[model samples]
Target chain A: MKVALDAMGGDHAPAVNIGGAKEALELYPSIEKIFLVGDEDAIRAECQKQGLSTTSPRIAIVHAPEVIGMAEPGAKTVRRKKQSSINVAMDLVKAGEADAFVSAGNTGAAVASATIKLRLIEGVDRAGIASGLPNEHGICHLLDAGANPEAKPEHLLVYAIMGSAFARHVLGVKHPKVGLMSNGEEDEKGTTFTKETFALLKGFADSGKAPFDFVGNVEGHDLFETQLDVVLCDGFTGNVVLKSCEATAKAMFKWLKKELTANAVRMIGAKIAKGAFVAVKERASAESYGGSPLLGVNGVVIIAHGGSTAVAVRNAIRVGMETVQHRVNPHIEATLQDVKR
Target chain B: MKVALDAMGGDHAPAVNIGGAKEALELYPSIEKIFLVGDEDAIRAECQKQGLSTTSPRIAIVHAPEVIGMAEPGAKTVRRKKQSSINVAMDLVKAGEADAFVSAGNTGAAVASATIKLRLIEGVDRAGIASGLPNEHGICHLLDAGANPEAKPEHLLVYAIMGSAFARHVLGVKHPKVGLMSNGEEDEKGTTFTKETFALLKGFADSGKAPFDFVGNVEGHDLFETQLDVVLCDGFTGNVVLKSCEATAKAMFKWLKKELTANAVRMIGAKIAKGAFVAVKERASAESYGGSPLLGVNGVVIIAHGGSTAVAVRNAIRVGMETVQHRVNPHIEATLQDVKR
Candidate 1:
């Protein structure tokens, strides 16, 4: 299996990407190759500096002339910068040269490039970004994290199906339970779009066309309960929820550390509770779940965090590889067909 | 000050409400009046069982003939059940018999009753539910928490103004900074509503009519940071973010406790780290911030948690009193007029 890595992406740049590529190659021996898509000279230099054996036959480089800044418009940048790292990596997946593509670049650029280059499945109208959130029970999937900000009821229905497919195939969940994220848990609690989407899901469930259980509306508080396998919402609400959770967790950990270091007694207490502290930190870490996957697209596309480190990038690559191995795209297409029929 | 308490509200029902009212009277000696609104017999029995004193000259009763179920339709229930506890309490505020009203009842019913009885302030199209999110860096006010599910850009602007006013007056922040919550921090990252709202806020900032500082768009991740005093968004996005944050904090605290009690060694460590644990718990506790206020209404209306205890109810009453004392409504009206002018 081959994976295309956008070495020019993320805050850590070529160094983190190179380190992650080395780690991925070591962990998965069956992974025959990695096509490092970026400025060839810069990536190679970073890899050499990291004291990695990049001279191996399995390692290769694909030069890209341009880079898309995080602030650039997604549609315009993807079209104008055709030779950008994201675009080039996506091309590798489209041409079947690489099984999957991983990027820690601007999310908008990565999403737009993937959708435009690899194309969407026949029945999929819009692609969604799915992120795994760690909850008390386990991990739950939130779809359309920030892809389409203004989604119609039909778009939400598609997200539900695609999210369910991803959960079942990649996350190893059987008979995944799907839910629409709304203001309240009741049937009549959401906006026009959510209400319409709920009706559509109900119809699909009654017709026995939906692949998983339609568990009705799930509120924000339900995200951490793991009551549903997949939580579906329009990009706007999903993004806000996703970002707020991330911010709150970071703030909580920061506050804990500050309070622990405030006095001598608390400092000693922090030392005594180091084990529990580590447990909490590990559970809240975003790197534990790797990167978000852009579902509904024809090929695998993983969008890692912009601030991703070596470990996060490696995890993202592994995620992309697993997605290909599990054939999530084809499964989503089949599910969409079922929902339509 | 006189407060109307809904005796038959919340999951705990008459017991919690009755006990809470007694505790409030005891805690706040200056609270001269209390009207227990519910079935006269049930409230009197509960008060007697708790061995509390409600025979003071300030104490009174307002019997509500019926109760609105939590699952009832907002508009229909509010209109039909005019004698419900929620309606009766709101009526006290409307009739100027009480300084403010407190309820741990159904949120929809509380909102509807408050809106119908108190009426919206002139120039304000709708009322918003505003909650104070307790983060590591103090508290940030989030508006339209679940009031209006489908909001226009103009509605968001109004929410921003109301949230700013509440934060400044009640939370004691001078020139509260307001932020428009969006998928990305970039100025152009939101949907049409977000983009237009951003432009409107910028225009306000440029024109010097806006009293608060418009801090530009804030991503969900910034909620914990004191980047802004008030965070503004439509009801749908705001509600999702609010619920998700609450759930995440609860789950994190629960997980920490469970991890600490796993074994004897950890248990001993927990004992040693009691101070640190308390610090963490206190920092994440939601009850510390009191209840969420419904803004833009003619009168002060606070929606306490449905599971509120005596302490929560008392704190909510204090919030209502503070809003009244600070003249938040008039301040908002004046500021809004300045913006229009």
Candidate 2:
């Protein structure tokens, strides 16, 4: 598979992206090619800085003049900066030169660029960003992570369908259980949007239009548990929960380190507890799931965080490859069609 | 201060409530009196079962005929069951016989009963439930935690003022920084409600109506950081984030235990890491916050979790006493008046 990587899109930029591309080429072997999209000279210099040469048969560069900052406005920046790294990388996916595109850049820009460049699948109103979080039972997929801040009930219904499709294809869940994120588990305990969405989901479940199990309402507390496979919500709530969890985990680790190093006895204890600490660290790391996938778009678009490291970038590339192999877009479109009919 | 304890409200009922009351009376020598509100026979029997005796100086029992189940509907149930433990406890607060009332009962019923029984402070449109979460920088308060699920922008502004007052008087943060929670940090990123709210908050800051620093917007990642002292949101989102954090912490601890007990080496390591583990456990535990206070009401009303223990109940009583001492209601009324004028 050929992947287009946004070489200048992340905090680590060309260095991490180039290093990850080199590693992907070395490990996958079957990954025939990678189009490193960024400014020519900068990309070349960073490749050398990382002790990597970009002259390999499997790797090449497609020079793009502009780079989108992580803080740039999504629609305005994406529309005006046509030759940006994200835009060019997505263009490669649209033109079928790359099976998937990966970027560790601004999530809003990535979503907007992908949707405008590659177009949405038929019957899909809006594209969503779906991220997988490690839960106590297993992994839970949270849909519409930040793509559409204010979504209608119809939009959420689409998220449920698309999320279910992604879970089945990527995680190998036979029949994903979908749940609506609400303040309370009862049907009457949510906002107007939630109430309307609940009724639509119930209709879908009763009619058996979708393949997944539509579990009623799941509260915020249910997110950490694998009570349902795909948890659906509007982007606003989903993004808040995602970022808060990340922040909390980071804060917990920082506090743990401080407490463990406070006294002589505890420092000695920390040495013996190293293995358990590693387990906890691994469980909290965001890179475990690589990047979130932009669902409902006509092609695969994977968005890693701007602060992604080499390992995260490499994981993102693998995710991109897997998404293409699993044919997630087609599956999503088919499910949407079934729901519509 | 005298506290009215609802002995019939929680899942554990008289056992936990009575035990908590006993602990409270024992722990806080400053507390002058306690009124155990529930069935007189059950309260007396449980006190005897624990081999604990409460003299007239420290404890008394108020007979109530009904108990609100955790699953009961809010408005109807609270009205019909006037003799319920929650109602009777509130009566104590209303009659000035007790400084405050504590209940490990249904949250909705408590909020409803409190709002109707202890009318809103003058010029305050709505009441909110504010819960404090421990953070590395300090404690962060999230208001409208689940009180008014369908809150308007004006209601959110009220929450901000009430939350700011709580942080100032109870949490002791001077000139607290208040933020409106939204999907993005940008002023224009949220829905109509958030956008209008952002403008209003900015106006308040410009006009010096609100004393706290009106930080423009905060994302979920700021929840644990010192970026904002208090976060303001409509009840729906606030409730979702609150529950999500709680559930995520619980799941993490559960995973940590299972992982630590997997092998003998790790088990021994865990034994040595007990101090560090306890620190992390205590930091994540919600009991430290005691319970959520229904702010904006004329009198002190605390809604403890239906699963609260003795430590939680005692801490809740302390919270009530502190609120009364701080004169939160009077301060709020004066602040609202100042804003209006």
Error in Å for residue B238 of model 1: 1.2
Q: What is the DockQ of each candidate?
A: 0.71, 0.66
| lDDT of model 1, residue B149 | 71
For residues B157-184, write the lDDT of model 2, one tens digit per residue.
8788888888898878888888888887
Give lDDT tens digits, candidate 2, residues A1-341: 99999998888788889888877887887699999999999998887887666787788899999999877887889999999999999999999999999999888889999988899999888988888888666778888888988889999888888888888998888888999988878677788899999999889889868778998889866777755788889888888888877777777777778878877877776776677778877777777777889988889899887778787888889988889899898898878777667
> Which residue pairs come into collision in candidate 2?
none
Docking class of 1: medium
Quote model 1's iRMS.
Answer: 1.5
Cα displacement (angstroms), candidate 2, residue A143, comes to: 0.9
Give the whole-model CA lDDT for all candidates, comma-separated.
Answer: 0.83, 0.84
Q: Which stretches of candidate 2 lie over 4 Å from their true place?
A: none
